[model samples]
Target: MDDSQKRETQQRLQSCLPQIHEIHSICQTPSITFGVVHNGEVIFKHSIGHRDAQQTLPANDETIYMIGSCSKMFTSAAVGILVDEGKLSWTDPIRKYVPEFDPVDDPRIGQEADIIDCLRHSTGLSPPSMLCLGPGGTILTDEEDLIPLLNVMPAVDGEGKERFNREWIYNNYVVGLVALIVQRVSGQRFADFVRGRILDPLGMRRTAVRRSDLGGDGNVAAPCVKKSNGRFHGLSDESWPCEEYTPLLAATGMRSCLNDMLTWCIAVLDAERSENDSSYQSQVPNNPLKQMTRVRRGYWTRPADDPEFSKDAAYGMGWFRADIPSSMLSAFSGNGFSREKEYRLHLQHILGKGSEAAPFQVVGHTGGMRGSIFSVFTFPETQSAIVTMTNGRDFGDASDFTAQLLIQALFDMKPTLDLASWARTEAQLAGSNYQKHIERPWRENRHLGDLERDPLLYVGDYRSFNGRFTLSIGGVADGWSTNLSVKFNHRNASECPLVFYRKDVYSFYQVDEDKWKIQQIGAREYKQMLLKFQVDEGGNSVEGLWWQWDADTKPAWFENVRNRNSTQKGAPFLVKSYSG
Candidate 1:
């Protein structure tokens, strides 16, 4: 495009900046850095808000932020590189490399599923609760530690035949296993291999696979949480240690800045061009890019009436592929400043009236963690990309919403719905509902009487059926009274005081202040952490316990070990002897 066209596009993008700022303010996001890549170059870039909670340091293009789960594509690229070197095959059985790769409920998955099945998330294994791998949880720091625990992590209950290669369950544990395979087959650490093969080659000097690499970098954005008072607070390193997440680093641990990410996006776009036209030279090779973006599982089919929405939505190796209506120089035929029509008028102001454009293929991925969120959209057909990253994970989908707004403006697509109003309403509802859910248990059970038996009877060490994880119930003094609190494995930081609900069931919310703060910011896991105790025959003693770790799945039962001499430590049982 000529200078006039570039100037028009820049002005149009500039007009959308106010809306971006409005959304960021509405969502209470701490920081955001976004850019648009066109024809293998960054044509537009913008940054808003502060990198720190104090609002002292302004976030810029160079401010580094954690790109959670967005690291999946890099892992996929690494695997593709291995395939290109003939070091591994997509069809090879996962068990061929890791002998302990077995699912407790379905051993056949380990025996039959291949590398592609795992990469495409077709193994029918739900992603395990990250709490299970927390500091004192079952899994250790090393990637290899996941192998033995894999056999105990249950598969989706009803997905029998589909568990092999039919369903898309998005298992991070499996991805970590894939990384381990990369490490073993390539004879190098997964992070080192990715650094040498992908990051260094692309000149992404600011990007690093390990959080420790960014230790002394003062330019890094601090992860933040928006509290109930509508203010952002930065979390300390001890509260949200990125290192404890090492086992799944290949799946979620990656830190990068806007400029480097833009460069990465351009390389992907250039690779797409090179794949189509042999004469076109790409800065990066086409082999891994082609393999990484190839769709392997269908997850969504657009409604027939929604012409502007995504269609045939599917998951590729790590990216999501969809066909969206794209246009150039389209005019707006509507009135008013409401979300529905105003976006179109904004488009018409930029690209004067023209015909509707054809549909274009778009591939992208979203990454989210405790206090960070990211979104990237690559228009392969148009050779353009849009990326947005934010330090605060708020009640709304701020990152994706900002990216979608940009996509609408850049493509000049006709307005089909009011995105801004819809997002705001949804965020409001989610926040309200979450607040209600958090209070419901205490509200409903406040009238119930005390426990039938002494709470000390339930104090013991309980091990899961597979003996992979342990939970210890101990006593905590509250004024003159003592209450029972439970901790997973031996993590004192995760200990929560149990509230008596009924005869044998009790509930507890996250006691860790940082985790509770994260839930306030919409993390939404463990809103109701219930524990049910089993009574032995004749009700003489506590025999077992069941824990509801995930709200969606059935409670996992653990046998009462009563092993006083066990290596794990817990508060001494109070009121030594209990009447039976």
Candidate 2:
């Protein structure tokens, strides 16, 4: 590296070191590794922090962090490899592979959601996590896969279309379904398939599906947690779901060291001037998967156009594509996982905290657990990427602030201190006017006359994928709980918990009858009802759209809400019922 570049790196590190060090002062974060690649050469490679705070075991070059949803790219790349070898077709419907396919609330709809729908997250159903784990509940899969999801109904939007297909919301059930497809078609389990297809071939020695595979390597960093006092705390626990969480293996189960992560990033930003045109090749005759980073789906985003509030432009396979000025390569935030969506909250804002698509495009992903935060950055034009993982979660500042400030320092940009101050000020103003925010009227329910008219015919217990939330009339809770239920003995095997976002309005749409199922809760507690109950007249088959409390606010992935001492963390927030 040039001396000038070294100086620049030092300056950037110095600017952010205080905050990061302050975080370390509270509790030493697990090992952190950083790798910088520019112009086809790795300019920087280093590891900082510890693997276990109490043990004082140091993290080194090979220590791995749970990459979580970043594995989507790996999954997609594996699928591409399979497709290249002529094992599966991209357009094939999931049912063609997993015939047990059938969504409950709208038996007609779930069966029809396709494989591409699963990858692009357009399946009508709200993601399984949105319903099963998003609220406080145990995940159904030993490997993190959603079992019997064909049974659960998806959430519907105001227009009655499947809310997930519309918004690209959380839905691991569909994602797991893809894993099933990979297994059935490739003759291998999803984890083995990816490892065999991609990792092993690429020589990703430090990556693995099981945590035990990591051995006693203390190079990995623990999760970072922000205490109520706004101080960051990092604790070490050698045992975690990465080793035990299996059901959604495709979702958030893999762990890898920095060396492997850096190598993976190099392949991603493979913007070689002369990339191979043929398949099975890279820009420098390397793997062609690198070029697949562009937006796969053109122009459209799910649920609606971009959210009125969030400017999410489009979703490409598992990657979120945000249109930014000046940069051709789109950017995306990495995804994550949690068995009990509510176990501990983490608001994932750091991934998108860098430059908002400007002179330099900021595209990266974020992963977190306990308090650890992992980041992967790619500057395609420069063939440069930075991977930072820290186990310490506290630093008087939020993760995004710490990360973006660091990024700005790297780019030599003047990250104004008052940039967030305005929002904080506005927040204070709104807080001062708290009654106004509280005065917003909640949505009222519409009559399900169609279901009511055909009531007796469709009144029996209906089931969907995640265990059914029954619609029984005998004795159902009145507030927020929808008598959504599940029974194994049910004639239709697709019975599982289902929640509705809004049944009344969903009944009016034409996209897919059951796709827009609402959670049973009224609009008061939730933004809208997300699931609904319905019975199939053909064979006493029952179904309903189901949902769990999404609890997460718009941008925060999982807000560690109990930390009230931190003004940002302490601000009062309510958990909304899943109403799509």
Candidate 3:
């Protein structure tokens, strides 16, 4: 591209900035920073909104925000590096390295599935509620906890299947396991590998595996949650310790700034040249990046009922691919500009997709965790990319919307949809009837006798295969009030008196409100819906406790390991009780 073309593109992109700002404002986002990568350089970059709700500090390009699941792309690249070195293969069985990851019982996908199956999310695994233990109840801190998941195979609608072939399941646990594989093969910590290989080579100085690595600099943007009242509050747990999320570090634990992120995108966009670039020789090979960005999986058919599935999209190793039809672009533009029409024709002529074929291909990913949201996209053929990050929780599709607008603007095409109006509507819907700890009303149809079961029968130590949490029930000083205790992992171990809210429903009010109050499997079911104890033939001894939440969310069962008549801290219990 020549200077005239570059100048024209910049002017068109500049025209879209005001609309971007309007969307950010209407959506009540605390802060947002966006950059446009054209012809191997970030020609247009802008940062808007305040760093915090106080509106005291203005955000800039240097402010670092958590990139969340976009970190998966880095992990996929790391695997590509391994594959390039002949150290691992995408078709290699996961059990080849991690013996604990054997899915032998699942007749359908166990033996046939390989490492690539995980990268493309063909493992048929879904997000497990038990694994989410971090802020916003969506992140995991332990790698060892992943072992128990082998016992529980991926199921569609709660039934084991003969095969899981077509459907896509977005799973973090599988990605976490991939990080472990990287560790086992590379003989180095995952974070160390990413920093030494990916970040250092690309001159991504502002990027780090953990927040503490960057230190307590005010340059790092604080994670903030937007309340229904159009206010923002800082997250209580400011730092996400990397050691706490060893396996998950590759899945979601990346922190970066606009400049570094732009550099990363440029490196990806110019992968062919970078393969021979001496700057990347000693650190990361570009061959891995080339493999990482190529499409490896296909998901063309959208759900029949889903109205949002109008476009065709697929998944690469860690990135997503979408084929944008020129006809659709024409419709979005309302046949407004002759330049846009010409540009659309140019794309059709180059990609061999005329007015009838899909003219453009977009590849990128979106990420979010707690108060941080990020999006990164690059047109491999056009040499254009967009990277945006905001300090807001509900920034899911907002990134895609912004990227689309910018892409359309680059071509000088007018957008048909009202993005600002859509964002405002989303904000209103998010704030609509915001309530804390939503639970269902008690079912009064149960017999009173059944409700008055022997409290002693429920007092025992129940355990799951994960061993992350232990459910313990013990008698109180009065022997009347049931004492409930939960030892979850090494970090959270607490006990409290069980407040009987309904028949077989107990609430541990002692748990932090933020952790439990915000934990909802569904719109109606809250965390207060404790285990419904399963009884034996005579209904005397308890066998197990089934979590009776909606099957669509928060589904797990704990079998009674021991029925100790007394809640002793030692002997059969073999676990420390929470003193508090």
Candidate 4:
């Protein structure tokens, strides 16, 4: 394309800025920062709304927000770097790298597990839910604790291995294990490896793998969670510290701004096209880029949660093949982000379909943490990318809404639905579902008074049979608030605080969904549990605890041990004495 054509396209795109801004407002997001990259340059960048609810701080193109699982791409790329060096192969048995790592107790499954299995989410392991909850589900924040955490996870039932491989199930624990493999093989902290090898090479100074790395000088956006009433509540903290979950860091602990993210996307777009002048190729090899972008596993059916996408949709190494409108792809090419001949050939070679002939084929990833939502889509056919970051969760529809509108405005497409009304209805439904677990009907029927036993009566340590978990009962912020905190295998300071609700029932709201982080807003809110303590005949000593996860009255019980070394009746009983 000539310089004159490029100028005309840029002018046309700039004219759509007003409609794009309106889309941000319509989503009711507290703040959204966006950037578009065309050809090799960042053609457009802007922000909307305040970083804080007080509206004191306006968000800008450089505001840092948690990218969550989007960090998976960087981690996958790091593995690619090692692969390029011949340090590892995608088919290498993970046990060869992280020798101590064994996903499940079943020896046959462990023996067959390889690096590809971790990236593809087909380890034949149990679902992420079973490995990430209660005593088995403690989040491993410290790198040194990874081996011990893996040791305790209940083995995947061997009988179900056949069924597990038949479907693609997302698992963060496996990704965390992948980070451990990277760390063990590279001899560097996972975060440090990514920064030195990936971030620094890309000139992404504002991008980091840990909260502390964001530094004090940058315009870091305050993380915010959306309430049921359509208002956003800014989180008290700015970044999710990587120290909290060392291995999980590879899965979801990166902080980045719009400027750096756009640069990363551009680098990816350029390298995928195999640009001879591209610095991305100079830093990271072509095989890794092709591996990360091409489909690794195809789904049998369209993702139920995202029905809009085609059933042909599938996951690549760390990215996925997303189907967008072909018209949008053409509009991007007209604006100067035209796909080079090399990129078209590469896409065709990997997809096994002439992706260039198809109207819509984009590769990217989406991520969400407690207070942030992030998305990046790079169109290899058009040589363009779109990045949307929002502080409000609102079921992550904020980013989705922004991406759709940006495409329509830039591509001159007509609206097909009442998007505003649709967004409001979806948000309302998600919000209602999120609040269900907290507002149980049982709460209203029960007496909202103090426990029959003195709060101090329950203050002590309770340990599981294998000594993997110990629950510490204590007073919170004076005698007014009662709390229970769990310590995993006597390492990593206690988390998962259970606050007093009514009588013996303690309510704990899980902030970190870890694996199921992308579920609909309502499904997320239901990750609550009610812990009801049982008393002895004297009513002075706590005897057991009942875990009430669902609304059903039936709950799993952990009977308190009367003697430290004695075997207790009931399932996986907890002793009152500390094991260590």
TM-score of each: 0.84, 0.60, 0.78, 0.75
- Residue-wise C-alpha lDDT for candidate 2, range 461-528, written one tens digit per residue: 32222323222222245475434333221312223343322332122111221121111111123332
lDDT leader: 1
State the lDDT of candidate 3 residue by residue for 1-580, as single tens digits: 7999889988988887788878777656678888898767678888888777566788888888888788888888888778878998878888789766655346445556677777777776555544344323334335675655543544453454433555677776678788889989999888888887788777777887866567676777767766435567666443353645665677777888888888888777666345445474322343235453333334333221122423545566667765554223222111112124333322221112223434566677777666667888777666678888887644223444466567666655433334565455445544432332232123232224546555667777765534544566665546455455433333342334455544454544323334332331222334434556667778788875655323353345666767443343222211222110
| Whole-model alpha-carbon lDDT for candidate 4 | 0.58
Better of 2 and 3 by TM-score: 3
Relative to the unseen true structure, what is the C-alpha lDDT of residue 167 in candidate 2, on a scale of 0 to 100?
A: 62
The better-scoring model by TM-score among 1 and 2 is 1
TM-score of 2: 0.60
lDDT of each: 0.66, 0.46, 0.60, 0.58
Ranking by lDDT: 1, 3, 4, 2
The candidate, 2 or 4, that scores higher on lDDT is: 4
Clash count per candidate: 0, 85, 0, 7
lDDT of 4 by residue, 1-580 (tens): 4788667657756665565566566556688888777665677788888888666889998788878778888877888778768887888887787676654445644666777677777655433332233332234233554554454343434353342355565666677788888877889888888878888877888997766677887477766655545556665442254544655677877889999998888767766566434444333332233333332233222242224322345566667664654222221111111123322221211221222334466676778666677888777766778888887764425775566555554444444223454445445554543335434533453455765445666666554424434455555555665455544224333244655667776655443433122222222223235567777777767876665322221233455545354554223422233221
Model 3 score (lDDT): 0.60
lDDT of 3 at 181: 91
Q: CA shift at 310, candidate 1, in angstroms?
A: 5.3
